[model samples]
Structures are given as C-alpha cells and as structure tokens.
Target chain A: MKLNRTNLEQRLDHLYDVIVVGGGAGGLSAGIYLQRFRLSSLIIDKGKARSSWMQSLHNYLGLPPDTSGRKLLQQGKKHYDSLAGDFLDGYVEEVTDAENIFEIQVKVGRQNSRNVKFYSKYLIVASGIIDHLLPLEDMQNVYDYAGYNLHVCMVCDGYEMTDKLCGFFAGSEASIEEMVFNLSWFTPKITIFTHGLFEVSGQMRSQLQEYGYRLVETPIQKFLGENHQMTGVELVNGSVIELETGLISMGARYHNTYLQELSLEMKGGNLVTDKLGRTSHPRIFAIGDLKVGLNQVVVAAGDGALAATQIWREIRKDIGPRKWLMNLKLPT
Target chain B: MKLNRTNLEQRLDHLYDVIVVGGGAGGLSAGIYLQRFRLSSLIIDKGKARSSWMQSLHNYLGLPPDTSGRKLLQQGKKHYDSLAGDFLDGYVEEVTDAENIFEIQVKVGRQNSRNVKFYSKYLIVASGIIDHLLPLEDMQNVYDYAGYNLHVCMVCDGYEMTDKLCGFFAGSEASIEEMVFNLSWFTPKITIFTHGLFEVSGQMRSQLQEYGYRLVETPIQKFLGENHQMTGVELVNGSVIELETGLISMGARYHNTYLQELSLEMKGGNLVTDKLGRTSHPRIFAIGDLKVGLNQVVVAAGDGALAATQIWREIRKDIGPRKWLMNLKLPT
Candidate 1:
C-alpha cells in the first residue's frame, strides 16, 4: 500500500514484517527483496537521499557513467512499488523496543504534519546522511553548482578536478589539513579557503608552506558561477579568487538521531554492523551511510540485499518453513 | 584496448594495474571502478557467466523484477567498455607470482585455442562457480527450463514455487536430507528424485516418511516441459512424476583452478577475504563466488567495488598521488 496521511491510520492497525527507514538505495533495495521473499515491509523516506544530489555516478556498474543518482533512486522506488512494497514520505522521530516489537513514531512531512506510529518485527535503518554545505544567507548560490564543479565527497570527485586550480573550502583547520593531502592526489595546485570559519594551526600553516600550497583566510561573500559550473568565490573583502573546481571539506549530518534513544552500538557516527549488515541489536539492521562501511550506492544496495536475505533466513528457521501454512484453509 | 587475438599479443606487453578474471557482474563492476580510478585494468571472461543463464533477477535494486541476469551482464559490459577498460574472451589457465607481478596464462577460444600470458600488479579472481545439473542424455531438454521453472538456488526461487507441486532433485544422500528441509518452506507436496545417483540411508528414509513426502529412486530419462516451463520428469521405468516447479541441489563447480599453485588460504572451496575482499596474499583479491560470502549478483557487484577501491587506495599511497604526473611533459 502506498502510505499517505489519509491511509497511514488504516495501515498502522496491522504490524508490518519490517519497517525500513529511508527510501534511498539501501531502503528501496531492502524493500524489493523483502517483498520478493513474501515479507510485508514499509519504507518511510525522510526526503532526498545524499546520493540524489549527486550530478553523476561514474562508478556504479551496469549504469550509464553519466547517470545521476536521482535517476537511480527514482527507478529504485518504481521497482520497489512494482513488487507491492509499501512506501511513505515521512521523517521518523523515535523508535522504542517492547515485547519483541519495534514501535516506530514518525512525523509525515516537514511542518505541521500528523504524527503516526508503526510496528514491525524487524527494523532496518537505511536513513542516509545529509552533507553539510556552506552556511550562507543565500545557500542556493552555493548549491547551484554544489554537485557539479563545486563538489563534496573527495573520493567520488577527486579525479574530475585533475590539474586544475582547485579550491578547498574547510570549516575547520582539521578538515583543511586532511583534505589537502587527499586533494593532492588529483592536483598539485591547491589553495585552502578557510572562509574565515576557523583559525588554522601554526603547524598546519607550516605544512602547507612546505608542500608549496596556498592558504586563504578571507571570509567569502558568495560563490561565483554560471551555468551550474562554479568558477570561483568572491570574498567579503571585495577580492575575488578564481578556481577551476572546488571541494567542500565540511562533514555530513548522519540521519540516525531517531535511533539514539535505542542505545545501539555505534562506531564514530555510524552503527557498526556485521558482514551481513546486522547491527549489535539482533532485530535491527543498518546499511548505507548509517553503517560503518564504504559509502557507495552499489555497496548500500548490496548491503540491503544481505540484510533482507539474512532476516528471511532467521524468520524461515523460526517458523519452520511455510509448509504448514500452505495446508491452512483461508477465508477467501 | 579491446583484446582480440591479434592485439592480445601487443596488449600483453604492458602490465595492467589489475587483471580481473571474470566478466560477470562482479568482474565488470570492478573493471568500471578501476578505470574510473584511472587505473589500467583488463577483464578476461571464459564466456557465459552463471548469471547470464538466469531467466530473471527479482532482487537486484533499481532494476525491474523481471530483468534477466543476461541483460544486467550485457549492460555491465557496455558500461565497463565505455570507460575504456580492456576485455578479452579467454579462460585463465594459470597464475604464477614472481617478483611482485602476477603472470596470468590464458587459453583463448575453446577449439585449439592460442595460449597467451599477461602480467598484472594485482589480481581479482571473480571467476564464479558453475552449477551441476542432472546428467541426463538429453540434459538440454532439462536446461530448456532450467533457469525458468527448474530453479537451482532455493534462496532466489523458493517463493516463486509457493503452494505448487515441487520436485527436489538431489545428487547425494546428504544433499537430499538438507534440501528437503529447505524446499518444504515453499510447498508440502515435494518429491525427492535421486535419479539413481545415491542410496538413501535408513534414517533419511524415515525422516522423509515422517514428513509425508515421496521419494523416487528411479533413473530419470528426461524432463518433460514446454515453453521453458517444466511439467514433469520421465523415469526409465516409464512413469512420469508431475511437478509444477523443480529445485536442483547437485552443488556447483568453483572456478579457481588457476590459483591452485598459490595456496594462499581457503575455507572449504571458497577463498577467505577481509571486509575489503583482500585475501591472505596482499596483491591477490577475491570477490563473487570465489569469496566466502552470499553468492548473489548484488553482493558480488558490491564486492567488486570494495576490492577496486581498496586496490586504488594502496596504489595511490605507494605512488604518492597523481599530482607529479600532471606536471610531466608529454611526448607530443
């Protein structure tokens, strides 16, 4: 059933086999597999996944190299829906475990929305992370080319910035120190832009000098770009710095806050999962950016499959197969 | 370069960064990631992958539930080729390690094929397993519906046979004992066909009797089917046991003979790998069916990405990034 405010009340009456948070690659993948396994599942998506903002996915296999992450997510949702998996656009607020059932409290939509509660035997948290972008009065100026020439995720876009005048936008000295080492792989001509966000350590400044790299400490007014291709940044001091490409070094906001009350084992900001994506909590499975593994779309999709299959194995073993159920006469 | 026999000799002269020994979902995924990482790679495929024979892939994310594995592999190959990754249709015969380079000997084509040797800094063994089918004189008659109705993987196709007349074709007594317990999940009406391959133990016979299941120890003449949907099996005794769907539990042939000389590490028939798909040997990575993990297309594709990213990180650290290379004057 496609879940909305009107039908959400009716659907909540019956407990789902699994409640998957976040309808991104991982959640959608899990939904499709669970439905194929004949398990009832519902996917509650907060909003756009971090991958959806990606301009192009150059590494995912079987896809056109230029395929955007948004297109993949759209297709994944369609695939999950085709299998009769339930889906809803809602932000999960809290989850509490009681008597082997997970009570999930969700708020549908962003503002002045109705709250709903759902119950599931198993819980899969695939709520992906949200990248932290530059804080500005008009953040849209930065986002205009955020996923284009102005990028995040050095691992995904470092190759695209080869040999160009690269700008590193850092929120802290530590971010600048680490990003410079990573960006050097693609280009030697790099300039670190502190954007007057934080003070750079003396040791970090010396290291940058030793590497023949430049550091700019001026606060930026707005990003200068055209046609969704970032060219440079204009500082508030009335001086403009030209750049061929840019990388944001600020970290991400992991959307696992709702899970904090459950007190599940966590490593850093991610939930540590076993090889099969099962968290320390037996009935809770974590995948994608929420788990301690490589944050790639393909990896997340694969994680979803493993978790779904493992859950099915556990359920199958417990119920001793569906043989007895076949013999039961139904009220049809 | 696309490696045909003509250019195979010339291409072998240059050592590839990584030589992937399979062109299935796993190998092609790794090839795409490697090329995107700006690393030279070559994929050597023996021919048709096990996935290529799959009638439908119901669990893979973002794809239609009815998408065939052959279609996925075809798209994966095209994606890899677009990134300029080299591909060859050949069977790897041997892999020898000497002086930090893997010398791979391959036999091209099946009939009086030309033997060729290639060198690589790293090796990814994605050569997946091949399933063993019933050895009937007219096995193609069985294969006509093998992937469609005569399924091999119970985990993948058990739901498809729900409440239907299922036939469990087991090669050995042990296989029958376990497969019967698993097949019972989908349907209670299951008949075990030994095909005169093994004698059923007394304990096993009693267990089948207790479950109200039928056991046929007859030598099968052929499987009767039409339009790629299995109908029944005809025995040499001239009796036909009707079945709506069938599950084959004859096991599989792991394709890692070329790495026998290495003797790196093994868990049963599979090579044990770390979270990043690294085997005991530092330069030798294993993914897909060769690795000890779930043998699914999505899992294999994820394994490929993990293996490729780890390989790239190692190479990047060793070479001190691509910055210096950017400054080098070209021959032109």
Candidate 2:
C-alpha cells in the first residue's frame, strides 16, 4: 500500500493558513480541529508539556490508573502524525504581527545555528505553564515519586492522598493559603509549613485556628527521604516533622514572554478569550493551559476545538463573496 | 482482595452537598472535582451522551482513530466508578430549588413506575444536549445507520466526507442555510434540500450559486436505501439526487425545560453561567452541554471542575470559625 511520496522540499512554497505553537494537549487538539475544518496547520514544539513530567495520572478519564505521562505524550504524537500534521522540533523565539500576518522567528537544534521565519494568517498559543521547582539540593530524588505518592493537583491525586499524613511545602505567598485550604479536602491531618513569613488576614487567622491546622513558619533545611520517597523534613529550628507525602505548592510560573509581546488582555493569567477562543489581538487566538482556567487535558482539547471552529468560520467569510470587513471592501 | 466494608450510606443520609444530574464526561469530571474538594456528591445519569450518536470521533485529541464512542463512554464511566462515585440510572423528571437546597424527582427501571426523590445543597447541570430526529416514514432504516454513515457534528466527522458526495438532510426551516454552508467545508459536491419553504438569504443564495451547490425545494416523498444506508432521495417533484453519505444537520434541541420552574436567566436558549459555573442563583451551577458556550466533552469537564471548585471554596469558608460569610461585624 506504499505509494511513492514526493519530497516536502518541493512543496516548500505552500504557506500554511495557521501555525500552532506548542504541541501539548491544546496545540494537538487545535491541529486536529483545524485539519478537520480543512485548514493547513503546523505545530512547533520544544516538547516540554507539564504532562510530560507527570509520572502517572489517575483522573485523566478513559486512561488506566497506571498510565504514564511518557506513554500519553508518545500516543498523542502518533495520533497527530496520523493526520499528516507537520512539525519541526524547535523553539519559537519571537513573534511579530503586522497587517494581519504573523511573522514567527524560531531557533531550532542543539547548536542553535538554524534560524527560520514563518508567516501565518492566524496564531494559537498553547505554550503550557511552567512549574516552579523546589530548591531542595536533592530535588530529583524528591520528584521521582510525583506520579505515585507525591502529587500537585488534588483533583488528580486526592483519592490516593486520603487519610495519609500530608505536608504542603509552600513558600511565603499565596501558596501557603492555597495549600492549607485545599489539603483539608483530602485529610484532616494536614500541616502547612511556610519557608518564610506567613501572611494572613485577621479572619483568615481565626479560620486557621478553627480548622486546627498546625502552621510552622520555620524553613526547611533538608528534605529527608528514602529511595525517591519523602520520609520527613528537617526544620531550621533543629526539629523534624515526619511525613508520608508532601506537595510543593510554590507557584506555577508560566513562560508568558510571548504574551507580553502582544497587546492582549489577561484575566487570571490566561488570555482573555470570548465564547470563541478569540483574544484582543483579532488575528491571534489562545487555548489550553497557556490561556488559563482549569488546566486539564480534556478542557484544553475543548479549547482547541472551539478555537479551530471560530477560525474556520472566519475563513468561510473571507473566502466567500462577502469581502466587506470593518467597512472595508475587498476586490471580489 | 475486595472487602465488604462498613455501610457508609447510613451516615450519608440526605447529606450530599451537591448532586450532578448526569454521568457524561461533564458529570464525571464534576464528580471527580467535587469529591476531591471534599463535597459529598452523587451523579445520576442515564449514561447517554451526545457522542453516543457518534461512530468514530476524529477531533477528540490524544486517542487513536479506531476508538469508538462506546469505548470512550465505557472508559469514562469506569474512571468515575473507580473513585467510588455514585450514579443512579434514571430519568430526571423534575428539578426544583427550595431556598438553598435542590430536589430532583426521578423515575427508575424498566417498570417505569418507581419514583424517587433526592436532595442536595447545590446542583450542577451537566445534563448534555440531545439531538432531534426527523420523521422519516422509513424509521427502521433511519435508526440503523445513525452512528455509522449518517453523521452530526461536522467538526467530528467532516474529514470522512472528503472526495465523497454528501447529501445534507435539512428537512427543517432552521437547518436549511446552516447545512448548506457547513457541508461546504468538506466537498464541493453537496446537495441541500428542505421539505418546505426554507427562507433563503441573499448572501446564502449567492454562495450557493458561486459554489454550484444543487438546492432542491421539493420535499422527499420517500427515502431510497438498502441495508440501512441511504443511496438517494426520491423527491415529490420526481427528482432523485444520488448520494453515498448523508449528513443530518437538521437541528439539536437543548434540554432546558427543567430550569424553567426556577426563574433563572437564559440567553439564546442557554443558562447564563459566570466564570465559576454560577448561574443567576448562586446555589445553582450549570456545566457541560446544558450551559452556554460550545457543547464539547472537554468544555463540559472544565465546567464541572469550575463548579466543583466554586462549591469547594464556599464549603471551606463555611467550615471555619465565626461565620465568615454571615455579615458579622468586624472589630475596627
């Protein structure tokens, strides 16, 4: 069934209608929808989606509890490739928009010698969020149990955390409150350790007292563990608190450098999109974790579909006889 | 290895904080979040989702093409049930809100005589949409090819229409123009017809002319088919438009009647929900296909998670000391 295929270099002159930057759940889903809508698309991925760091995901529907993050990404890439979607393993360095056409500058490869410019009519930024790692010297040994015992999302791993003595490793900001309140859902034996000064309102302090949460303002000198599993934490006060599992509720720092370049509005760290996935920048759209809201795989996929459908609707209007846009008439 | 544990039902009594009224992707995802948020929740569903009408879904990312809608649903349910999530198989006859509580009346079983009532502090409407079926005097033949060759959701099945002549069965006033325009995405060889006067717009008429789409105003006297797959349409005008595949773009009627008893705000036949899945009434939340925005599984799941998180935030505020939400006079 193998037919002789022509080289892609011969077809280099064909410009894509849209180029999706990032190939995580959001980007891949958007690509699937665009291709179905009959629009040519390409995905540029540095291959570091948050799901890649996941050891195992229990809440990802339709997947087995033993499903590994590595396996999930591999399967997703295969599915995208099956559609004949194009991809270049590289990093998008900068983007500039002028006259509704986006000029993307990408730096690819190890030596970083290769530089290429791509022009697209529309852009969808699915660049996912980046996790702030704990500054423990032995952080690698601590992260090995991420998919199994230690976890980030309570919705994804709370069932496993139920009835277990859990420790929330938070810094001196909103992470302290987020951990103290959310960890209450899984177990009552919860302790919030602030590596610095604990900030709280008067009412919040009273609530903490009522909830009976043991709060320690002391910092952690060392993370004691055995075979990649955390056992206890040595405090700066020359004391230790034994624990089975702990979540580093520091903060999710998104690589939103590209977003700063655009004159787009932001709400809750995600691109402010309407019912359709349209940003303030009319020609550009954003979906998935990059755009914000619940950072789930399924939600990201839906964002992709919604964005693709909106783009398709626009294409239809442009391709049709109605060349009048914003009172400007086109030669039809 | 399974143990018949102690009965937790006696303690549960009418204590469910939230009751999600469907077990589709939206309901299950909501259940997962609600449970993780420490809300005593139950999901009652008949287990029939919109995707149930799909044979193969090509746009739902991260899965192989050979995956069936049934497999997706089965796996989704398995994921929910594994988390000790409760779902009753029944049809929700009525949903009435009283003060801050919700009462759901249901009819269960094949006998169709048993009635039951369930109560919850809050409600999340993940009850997805239902597709409306047309009266084809040939009922037996029409039902057989439902999820196979006959399709809905062009975003899900449009890729299969490539290089194939598609016959769109509009049959209704609402679907006439939409069907003609949407089907234009896949093939140029598209024929659209209405059973009666399909008020054609000036712009639409020109698109039809430019695209060379055959439009027939005559009603179909009979459906031409064998082995449950349609081959052609026999028009009352004694005309026959042969087609290999058919798209029933007729229309989908949303189930919003249950919300009518309560005077909730509605916009364009959808419940008006805020960013946190809150309806006009704070006690009530809407998720999945029943609410506003794109009717997608992923979006529904996102709605469910948001609703659960909103409810969780409220519960945490409730559990703390000194009635933080009761307008207590704060000391200056």
Candidate 3:
C-alpha cells in the first residue's frame, strides 16, 4: 500500500518486522524479499535516490545497456507492491533505538506536513549518497549535463568516454591523484580542471607533466553545452577548451545523519558492515552506498537480499516453529 | 561472439583477460562486466545451470514474478553478446595454473568432438551445482514435476508451499532434522517421507508426533498426479498419502572438479572467498553457487559485478597509463 495521510495514521502503531529507510533499488529489493519471506516491511523513502539521476545503466547484468535507472526502480516498486509490501514517501528525520524496537520519526509531506513515529523490530539503512557537481554560478547548467556527458562515476561511465577528448573536473588534489590516472585507461586526451578549489603539489605537477596532461586552475564561468551534451568549458580568464566528454570527480555527501545518536561504527564516511550488511547495532543493517562496498546498482541489490535473508533467519529461529506456524499467514 | 568448431581453432592461441567457467547467471554477469570494462572474456559453459531448471523465479527484483530462470539467462546472454563477450557451449575438463596465466582444457561437442585449450590471465569459476533428485525407477516422472509444484530449495520456494499439505522427502535423517522444522513456518501439515533410506531415531519420531506430523517410512511405488502437478504418492503397500506440495531435501553435486588441481580454499563444498569473491589464488575468482553465499540469481549477479570491478582495478594498476592508453581501443 502507498501510505498517505489517511493510511499512515493507522499503521503508525503497528510494529513492522523491518523498516527500510530508503526506497531505492536496495530498499525495494529488501522489501520484496522480506515480504516474500512472510515478514512485514515498511519502506520509508526520501524520494532522492542517486539512481534516479542516472540517465542510462550500462553494466547491470540482464538489462539492456540503454535502460535507465529510473525504469528499473519503477519496475521494482511495482514488483514490491504486488507482494503487498507497504511503501511510504516520507523523509526519516530521526531513529531512536528503543531497546527491542526502533522508533522512526518521519515527516510526510513537502508542505504543511505532519510528523509521525513508527516502530520496527529491525531497520535497514539504504539511504544512498549524493554526488557533488561542479560549483558553477548557474547550477542548472551543471544539472543539464550531469547525468549525460558529464558523468560522476568512472566505474560506470568510463566506457562511454573511451578515447574522447575528456575533461577531468576535480575538487581536491587527492581526487586527481586517485582517479585521474585511472581515467587515462579509457582516454589519453584528458585536461584536468581544478576549478581553483585546491593547489597542486610540486610532486604531483611533475607527474602530471610527465604524462603530458594539461592542468587548469581557473574557476569556470559556465559550462558551454547544448542538449545535455557537454562540449567545452568557458573559464574565468575567457579561454575555451573544447572537449567531447566530462567527468565530475568532485566528492559526495553521504546521507546518514538520522542515526547519529546511535553512534554506530564508521569507516570514514561509510558505515562498517559485515558481509551480511549488519551494523554494530544487532538489529540495524546498512546496505547500498551507506555501507563500505562498491556503489553499483547490482551490488546494492545483492546487499539487500543478503541482509533481508539474514534477518529472516534470525527472526525464524527466535520465534521457533510452533509460534511461526500459528501466527504467520500465507501471503495470498 | 559465439565460438564454434571453425572459429574456436582461430582464437585458440589468443589470450583473454578472463575466462569464466559457466554460462549461468554469475558467469554471464561477470562476462558482461568484464567486457564493459574493455577486458576480453570468454565464458565456457557446461550447459546445465541449476537455475535453468527453475520453472518460475518469484524473488528477482525488477522482474515479473512469473518469469522463468531460463528467460533471465536468455536475456543475460543477449546483453553479454551486445558487449562482444565470447560464449561457447563446451564443458571445461581441467584447469592448469601456469603462474601468471591459466590454461583451460575444454571438450567441445558431445559426439565425435575435439578437445581444445584456451588461455586467460584470470579465471572465474561460476560452474554451479546440480541438485540430486529422487532415484525413482523412471527419472522422467521425477523431472515432469521437479521444477513445478515439487520444489528443491526451501529458501526459494518455501512461500509457494504455504498452508498446504506438504510432503518433505529427506535423503538422510540430518536433512529432515534441519529442514523439517523450518518448513513448518509455511505449513504445519507436513509428512516426513524417508523412502526407506535412513532410520529415524526415537527422539525425532517423538518430536514429529508431538507436532502432529506423520512419518512415512515405506518406499513409494509411484507418484500420483497429472499434467506436471503432484498430488500424492502410492506406497508399495498400496496406500496413498495425498499432498498439496512436496520438497526434495536431497543434496546436490558441486561442479568444481576442474578446479581440484588448483586446491583453492573450501568451506564445506563451497569456495571460501573474501568479500570480493577472490579465492586463495590471486588470479582466480568464484561466484554464484560455487562461492559461499546466498544462492539467489540477483546475489550471484552482484557477486559478478564485484569480482569484475576488483579485477579491473588490479589490471589498471599493474598495466599503468601509457600502455593502457595506447593499447586499449574504444569498445565501439
């Protein structure tokens, strides 16, 4: 059920078997497995999945190379609904660990919204990260080509930029040192644009010169492109460098603030998870980009399955056979 | 390209970046990712994946619930082919580790066939397992209803047997002790059928009686049903016990004989790997049912992506920029 104001009031008192924090590919896949395993799940989505911004997914197995990320999520949502999993479009403000169950505080609407609290025995944090784009004056110009020719992930879109006149936009010197060399595997013609964010070290400058890579430290006036295809960039010095493709290697902001009070174990910006996506808290699981793993749609989907299956096994073992046989209903 | 007798001879001397051992979901997925990363891969399949016997896949997210496993494999093959990954219908006989590269021996075709050798820098063992069905007089009778109303995996088809009169066929007393209690989560009306294979202890018999479960030790004469739907079994004593569903808890045969020469790490029958599906050997990987993980198609697909990405990173680091930039071409 798509929980709205009318339906959300009644479900607030019910304790779900598992409450998923986001409805991206990972959350939806988790919900589907949980529901099929005869566990009650409520997926609370903030409606800002990073996959929603993907124009085309080329590496997901079995899917056509041109299939968009949104299309996959839509189909997943429909499949979850068919299995009778509850889904709500709400932003989770806070999660309080209440001994046995977690109290999740959610804000329902964008305007004149009411805050509500729901409870769940287990929680899955699938809230993914958001990538930071180039800090241009007109952010709309960056958005126009962000998911297109201006790609954010090299692992996903490197094939699309193979052997093209590519522009590497970096926010920090570390980003260039880590990724710029890897990007050369796809294309040799790379021009590094620092956007005046950080100074390049003398050692790094010599290495860049050795590789015949041009470095630009000037701030960008605007992205010069039409029809979601980035062509070049106009710098503050009024110089233009034509390019066929662009990569935004600026860092990203991880979205995991709701569980700040829990003080879960963290590795840098990501949560430290076991192979089953379990966090330090026994009942809480962190999957997808929020956990320490590769940020791919297929990998996240697999994480959801592993986490949900482990949770189900725990619940089934704890409840025992007689109680489960009497209490649970066939999901017909 | 689909390698055949004619084309296989020409590409015999060519070395691939990766050689996958199965054409199931995991091997195909790995091949897809490797090809997308501009690494050459060839998937040599033995033609019998456990998933190919799955009649309907209900839990794969983003797919219709009624979609068969064979349909997913067909689509995955098409997707892999679009990226120019080589696929062949041949059984790998042996794998010899030659330090940096591995030499694979394959037997092409069943009758009047020729043996061939292929070489690869990395190897992925996705050659999955085959479940052992009931050894009836006529095996066709078992195959007629194996993938339909009768089931093999409790994790995959437990929900499908909900609230029905279930018949649990166990090969050993251990299989009954482990799975029979879990089956009660879906239905309490379970009858344990030993088929005169193993003796039931008094403790187990009392436990079954306490739960109101029937224990039938008599060997069956034949199964009763029509049109691929099993209804009951006819015992040798001319007695019939009706059933709505059946679960075969027999074990499976793992297809990893070709890798016995490598002597990789093993946990029971599965390959013990790190989170990235890397075995004890650095250049070899194991995914899907061959690795110690959940036996879901989506999970295997995710494992493929992780293994392929890690391999790509290793290759990119070792090859360096100048060589990769000059050697690798755009996949178009």
Best TM-score among the predictions, by candidate number = 3
Which ten contiguous residues of candidate 2 chain B have the minimum total lDDT? B1-10
Off by over 4 Å in 1: A324-332, B322-332
lDDT of 3 by residue, B89-196 (tens): 998999998879899999999998889999999999999898888888988888888989899988889889988898999999899889998888888889889989
Greater-DockQ candidate between 1 and 3: 1
Score residue A210 of candidate 2 by CA lDDT.
Answer: 61
i-RMS, each model, one decimal? 3.3, 8.4, 4.0
Give the lowest summed-lDDT range of ten residues in model 1 chain A.
A321-330
Residues A1-332, model 1: lDDT tens digits:
78898877778787988999999889988888898788899999987898899889877776777889999898898888887889999989999999999999999867779888999999999998888898878889988989899888877787788778898888888787666876787787888888788888899877776666778988889999899988888989989999999899888899998998889999889998899999989999999989998889999999998999899888878887333344344546
Lowest-sum lDDT 10-residue window in model 1 chain B:
B321-330
Model 2 docking category: acceptable
Best-first order by TM-score:
3, 1, 2
Best by DockQ: 1
Question: Whose lDDT is greatest here?
Answer: 3
- Chain A alone, TM-score for each of the models? 0.96, 0.85, 0.96
DockQ order, best first, reads: 1, 3, 2
What TM-score would each prediction reach against the true structure?
0.95, 0.86, 0.96
